[model samples]
Target: MSRIRPQVRISRRLSTTAGVAVTTATLLTAALSPAAHADTRPSRATAIENAAAALLAHAASLGLTSAENTSVRDVIVDKDGTQHVRYDRTYHQLPVLGGDFVVHLAPDGAYRSADRSTRAPISLASIVPKIASPEAAGLAVNALRAANLGTVLKQVKAKPELIVDALHGTPRLAWRTNAVGLDSLGNPVARTVLTDARTGAQIDAWDSIETAAGDGKSLYSGTVPLQTTPSGSSYQLKDPTRGNTYTGDAQGQTDACILSICISRAPAVLFTDADNHWGSGTTADRASAAVDAQYGTDETWDYYKNVQGRNGIGGDGKGSYNRVHYGSNYNNAFWDDSCFCMTYGDGDGTTFGPLVALDVAGHEMTHGVTSKTAALTYSGESGGLNEATSDVLGTLVEWYANNPSDPGDYLIGEKIVKPGFGHTALRYMDKPSKDGSSADYWSSSVGNLDVHYSSGVANHFAYLLAEGSGPKTINGVSYDSPTYNGSTITGIGRDKLGKIWYRALTVYMTSSTNYKGARTATLNAAKDLYGAGSTEYDTVAAAWSAVNVN
Candidate 1:
């Protein structure tokens, strides 16, 4: 099985300035100051807004001109009061692609350092498009159609927005168009096309759907407990505890779309049961699959909330829904941002069973998490990172669950892949190359591989980071992870790995980050969480080197 998603571009530059060290006397003096007593600390939002305003006021130092403006994308205030502010830039009112950057400030609001997506100056010749929006949109639709060659597309629609393409070489006026329609399977297919506004040539294009190769009987996890909502005499497969997240029976229906319009969408008919007991742990019962889907969703939600401190997938305490039995023998699962939901395929039965495994559920939901945070473009190295992020965290989610039936392992989708698939699992984090297509070490050509296979680099790094090199048995599963440079590495434990990677994804990484960027992000994250030169920080560096990232 394979997966596809959208893409972005990134190049980073670091600018640092020394901050004055705060002394105990300075702190005591400030604590006793009348202004300190009179001024209550501002709200987090206010402080971040104030910081953005201050940073904008000194735009020249940040490599920005008066013609550029910024809006906040994300903000992180550390335990030590250090602030990291991420912003997106607009040049002359046109969005600047790859013009995003993060500014780090000291506790005293002094400039410390910055990570810019691109160091190139943004100065487009003109915002006006000679090719026009309609023409650009037509080209985008054609590109989309060309990409999906044998499939008949319906409800085809293309929407083009003009932007400054700072992502590619030399910032220039371009049209970023999203062309969407339904594939032959009735699955919504979309491509985001970037076209040179002046020349009317296609610059770049990528699939917008975030997908995973594989889902349930109560399938993989055996029989699991579920939280349901009472609706009259029957119970709805909705968990009130986890933000009303419910599992709906798609009833073998698929989505219908034309261009941007979704004419006949699959209805998430609430799965209702008279007795509260859901699923017989077999596909013979419809509630059986629903049970697995609901359980997987619950475990994923709990893993993020309990281990990662995220309130929900978006960290906003909002729940995302799940749709099971999506399409007849659909064979794939996806996390759709537009619907804020997870949809699973029933599989062709020979290649796969139900697409609702716990790790698969976690993997799909983590896509939502990535979209909310780094928004790593789903192509090239960044796309690989995006997929690897999900794999890493999804593995952690399985470990966090500690379910007896599906004990955690470094393998992904082990429960979903059928015997006819000719593989034990969809992916192996400890030795990704075992699957035949994945790359175990980083190389220039690694980015040229599919995002799933390229993700092997990070997955290998994560396995080495958590379990180290050489053979070992974790939870009865054996692994012998090797390093790229043949250097021995000692395990740092998965708990620390989770903390470091989560922080990197949420605080340090940008949308366009690549393999090298990921190394930097994780190193910075380790330094933030475990201190510079700490064992954990050193291990993070060693792990990346083991994966040939350095």
Candidate 2:
């Protein structure tokens, strides 16, 4: 793309750490053990009912009751049968901001504790806003302008919602305004501005759009099947069979942003060709990149649905479109949650060519999955995990595709690496430290490093968990993974690794989960998928320990 979307784009940074040595004997001794019994439990419905009843019994003390019009938002069950039920409340039929809480339940369905986002109850004098809705919208736009986001073109929809502000200060009524448009790069833009209805003071503002910028191929992925729609005269790039996922051409303009708010993007005109067959497998042809972008989108959609049981990126079975040939020789790709689309860049042709490589495609799209679920904050250890999640799934997608042209391996961005980049890939899971910056083992300061580098800890852990620590070859790729405690970990196979990680991501992880939280999350995931004392569970524990995540 002409301008890279800055918010969620993955940045590759290189830094080094002195390897903290540990003895093999110590590692084996430090390995994690099963924490609970694996006996069969009650049916899901029964367990949920018991947990709900337990929470209701303590509702009064927790500032919740039937009169508050609170309803369960989600119910999460951990491996130890602990239930975490998140509830959303409404005050006088109006949604209450900060009126959400998670009720923790013991394995026996007893109330253990409750974590409330808001400290105080949803007690408000009036739910009505003193400021008019139009005036609230104006305040939001002004706030956006104050934040250097002056253009507010696309005005998707603006509405006022009531929320309580007890967490930050004294409880009071507020209005939350959601505005979406386009940015300067034609990528989607959005902001949720919270204003004090009593005084019209801007309380908070956050970008609604989660972005990470993308693709082509014929240049990357080899000849592949594409789903197309016939538009009377010619076929369009839209895929009707796959939730109508389509590919549009930016035509290198980068100024098609509309709605005044949308970023200045190349016009997203649907890609159409006279012949059904597209692309020449070279950057000289525009369809080449479009072909790669479209193919990648299809593969990613299928991978999530068929492998992970996810219907779509948002798990809603809705097809998202792709923008190809974005900007002139842009060197990055990103995913925009606001637009629900993936954008790809044509590589500068030096260090990179077209970025629509198979794994990269999967890597970018998994960001959306991360956004929809867990919603990991893009900083610190959580950010590292976020990037690692994408890398892990992206590698799996490549493996799932089983493309001969680009075989699946622990190497990322392998196909796009420049000759003089020194390393063959962007990051190496087998030996992440080989990237010159990634951490092979976790440390207290790991979170302080660049997320891309911090992800090395998890990447190395995944490699050991899946293929073990040793020198080996798979699909012509060789990997030798090292551990923190200098221990040898046996392989659990990639399929099991994928299952455990996916489960943890969708079920146990939260926005603020850290490295320690990740260990618990995966352990719980493994226990839930396998038995508590099962080999998978032990392997997960062992893997985390090997990476110094314990």
Candidate 2: tens digits of C-alpha lDDT, residues 1-550: 2112222311111221122110011000001122366645443454456645655567667776433545544445555566665555566656665565556677888877765545566667777788888888877766655544454444344555666654345667788776655454443445668889889998766544333231234887778888799899888988898889998887775433322344345657898877788888887888888898888888898888777767777665688888887766666677766577777767677676666777888888898887665656566687789888988988899898888888889988888767755667888998898978889899999988867788889888888899999888888877778787888899899999998998787666765567988898899779878979998999999999999988
Candidate with best lDDT? 1
**Candidate 1 colliding pairs:** 6-378, 155-258, 155-259, 156-259, 157-259, 215-354, 215-355, 215-356, 215-357
What C-alpha lDDT does candidate 1 achieve relative to the native structure? 0.79
Residue range 382-447, candidate 1, lDDT tens digits: 888999998999889899889899999999888888898888898899999998899999999998
- Each model's RMSD to truth, in Å? 7.1, 11.8
Candidate 2, overall lDDT? 0.70
Candidate 2, residue 462: how far the Cα is off, in Å: 1.4
Assess the local accuracy of residue 124 in candidate 1 as a C-alpha lDDT between 0 and 100: 66
Model 1 quality (TM-score) = 0.89
Q: Highest TM-score: give the candidate number.
A: 1
